[model samples]
Target chain A: AQSVTQLDSQVPVFEEAPVELRCNYSSSVSVYLFWYVQYPNQGLQLLLKYLSGSTLVKGINGFEAEFNKSQTSFHLRKPSVHISDTAEYFCAVSSLGGYQKVTFGTGTKLQVIP
Target chain B: EAGVTQFPSHSVIEKGQTVTLRCDPISGHDNLYWYRRVMGKEIKFLLHFVKESKQDESGMPNNRFLAERTGGTYSTLKVQPAELEDSGVYFCASSQPGRREAFFGQGTRLTVV
Candidate 1:
């Protein structure tokens, strides 16, 4: 069984400040990590994914995340956030063993204060 | 280029009533999935379909729910005698075979009154 834990339930930051959403996972086999964002009353949109290759993965809207194998963490970061970036973010993981069952975190709501 | 689409953005039904939700996936996406999120709960997977074939349905709650994907295009989920616990946001996602990322629909919010 695989599970994900998002440390913070809500995060408040200035409009131009950097933000980080921490995520950790527990899995018996190798896993693929992903970050998704959802606006109010909207479905989730994929931000970035760490399948393989480079640990640092860049995504749309100037967001990025680093996959740390030693720490079992995949934290999303953005150098500067805008009001448009305020949304609920979710961290998810899927095992490489063809389980195909993606496990998601509870979700962290990012509140951008102008 | 259209994303997944679902019918009846919101529904209010009494207990013991039957409801059927529809989903139209993106063109040519063979893999379809069903997931739901109850109040204050994380989203949970219900089932998966690969071109009308059941890939995995281990997450289905019970026999009260039935899902079908005919013609390998659109899908439907039927709930018979829905209980109050069945109230939640139902999401439909679709993706191409072997693709990792799945596109989601706006979702159907079911309220069991």
Candidate 2:
């Protein structure tokens, strides 16, 4: 079984300030990590993923995440924020042993205040 | 390359009414999936299909939910006598074989009154 956790339900930050959205997962087997963003009324868009080699992955819209195996975490970060970056971010995990079903986190809504 | 597309972007029906959601996945992608998010909760897996075959449906909530993928093409999920608890955003995703990432649709917002 695989599960994902996003502790913050909502995060408010000032424009140009850095922000972080935390994510953690638990699984008995190897897994793949992903971060997706959904703007208002938009579909879920893939931000980045950590599959094999790199622990740190960069995504679109100036976002990035690091995969920490020992910590069982994949936290998303942005050095600076923009008003257009306000959206709901989801953390997901899928098993590496051909289990296609993905478990998602509750999501964190980022509100960028100007 | 077209992304996954879902029909009836929004629907509102009375309780006990039937509703069917449609999803057209990306071309040549044999893997399709269905998930739902209710009341701002986590997205829950519903089912998965591999070329007209029901690969896994362990996450289906109940028997009232019937999903069909005829001819390995588009898929439809029908809820007979939908209850208020079934109201949520239904998402459709598709990915190619051997790929881990899936592309999602805009989702169908179902409202049961």
DockQ, all models: 0.72, 0.90
Model 2 CA deviation exceeding 4 Å by range: none
Per-residue accuracy of model 1 over A3-106 as CA lDDT, tens digit each: 99998999999999999999999999999999989899898899999999999999999999999999999999999999999999999998887846688898
How far is each candidate from the true structure, as Cα RMSD in Å?
0.9, 0.6
Please give, as one word, the docking class of candidate 1: medium
- Best by DockQ, which number? 2
For model 1, how does the per-residue alpha-carbon lDDT over B1-113 read when each residue is reduced to its tens digit? 78999998999999999999999999999999999989877788899999998899998899999999998999999999899999999999998888888888989999998
- Alpha carbon lDDT of residue A8, candidate 2? 99
The candidate maximizing lDDT is 2
